[model samples]
Target: MTNPDDPRSLELVETELPQLRDGEVLVKVQAAGVNRGDLLQARGYYPPPPGESEIIGLECAGVIEDPGTTGRRKGEAVGCLMAGGGYAEYVAVPEGQLMPIPEGYSPTETAAIVEVACTVWSNLGMLADVRPGQTVLIHGGAGGIGTFAIQLCRELGATVAVTAGSAEKLETCRELGADILINYREQDFSEELKGKCDVILDIMGAKYLQQNLRALNEDGQLIIIGLQGGVKAEINLGALLPRRLTVRGTTLRARSLEGKAEIVRSAVENVWPMLADGRISHHIHATFPLAEAAAAHELLDSGAVTGKIVLEV
Candidate 1:
């Protein structure tokens, strides 16, 4: 739990095991994934949904310790897409949010894959309906979501373009199948991709709004998943009208239980096969012991990490 006064002060302390509700199971967590949303929660900017756990983690891989009325066998290994509470030793997971671990993936790898896979698949595959021959632009291409999105887009037969902060990061994106790489620090991605992107996956929020609009082709869609940049921005309504452009913002954690369950099911059905066959690979930049979660948060916040971070229990 974050301290109200000093939000960055993370400490490991004993807490009661979460009680399982109907249709939920108790999972003994093996590893948990660290995400930018955790950082925001620690900073008091993001809060878990009502009636959810106060713990920071959003995804984990674990064994079912108590299969409370879910009919799942105890000791089953599962990857969990969570609303919250994944950072602890034990978490109560809704049965619908549980997924089988991909073949050839360990707990840490599974932890790294769950949240990003569901997010990317839900937005690109389900909502945007990304198709072959369409161009997709991803911001922060070297990060966890960006890297996963790049490979997934390639698998969907889309032309992938990415923007990263450095040439080294761009190279990483290239290796992951990004067709066009723009170093955002050196090049204006919007200018380079003007009216070329069929879909733009944006994390920068307001800072990139106008540029993202400029970069979109007619009838393009912009999916804003993160608000790393400021959230308030003025948009020209006329511009959107003439271009038939659409902008939608979404958050997985805030969705209804049924909504999350649908996403989890879709991700498992579609993305798990890719993971199992190595078409889309999970990337873990680093791992820290669960107790060193503060340090892990610092590392991710430093902007040096190229992929996901996992906290091992």
Candidate 2:
């Protein structure tokens, strides 16, 4: 399966799964979650963490083949984020990153749900400390993490506003509980949203920096999770300081195993109940076979998807 002719564009030739380490479990992957970073990694822009597998998928849902005395049981339905490599038919993941698939959810569905929940929970729920009735302006509201953020923030009693490229995507955001929709292509978001936001969750850091600052209310928090538009930015510290705005940035991929595991555990405890009760649901825009990973990358790169995309192995 590792040869050039193997037909899986995401996997390099001669790639092989290594023996499971002491705290690792082998997963028979049924589906893998696709993220924009996966495309970057395929193009050699993002490198896997040292000592982790070189395979390119960050998250997957599947059945456990062996638990390796890691407290996981064989045949347990589980989802996990790999340091690398989830596009393959099987992946060995550290036990710490593993979470059981919510009851009755398909592996394909669970694959799409896990990554978004973890990302939003860590950023909005844990870091930002979003409070009830506060307004959250989320950039890319129709994308994977944005969709989840809308639902999670609403569940926590925050008013959600989203910026998307189209009215159609905005409608989807509305269904997900977004109270305000700004079509960025047609309007200046900062000008439209001026003085309306209590918190801003941004992915296009530099592209939206100045305006994002302008949109915030006093004591607002700006949490940046991605630099989709480019990293460099110039900010007036006076604007930030006088407004009592807090600016923060983070990346989930570089986190320690323990930190990631704690996030997974917290999500299971606090957020999974919402899923079980149907208060939060996943929105899957499309699914592709694992072998057609390049096409999945193309779809995400085009920015045409309204929600999460998944790969069935």
Per-residue alpha-carbon lDDT of model 2 for 1-313, expressed as tens digits? 2333322354335456667998999999999999987877776667788888777889999999988869778898898877777888889998888888776688998999888889999989888888998999999999999999999999999999899999899999999999988999999988987888998999998988999999999999899988888899998999988879889998888999899989998989888888878899988999998878877877888889988999998
lDDT by residue (162-279, candidate 1, tens digit) is 9999989999999999999999888998899999999999999999999999999999999999999889999998989988999999889999889999999999999999999999
Q: Flag clash pairs in model 2.
A: 55-85, 56-85
Model 2: lowest-lDDT 10 consecutive positions: 1-10
**Number of backbone clashes in candidate 1:** 0
| Residue range with the least summed lDDT across 10 consecutive positions in model 1 | 1-10
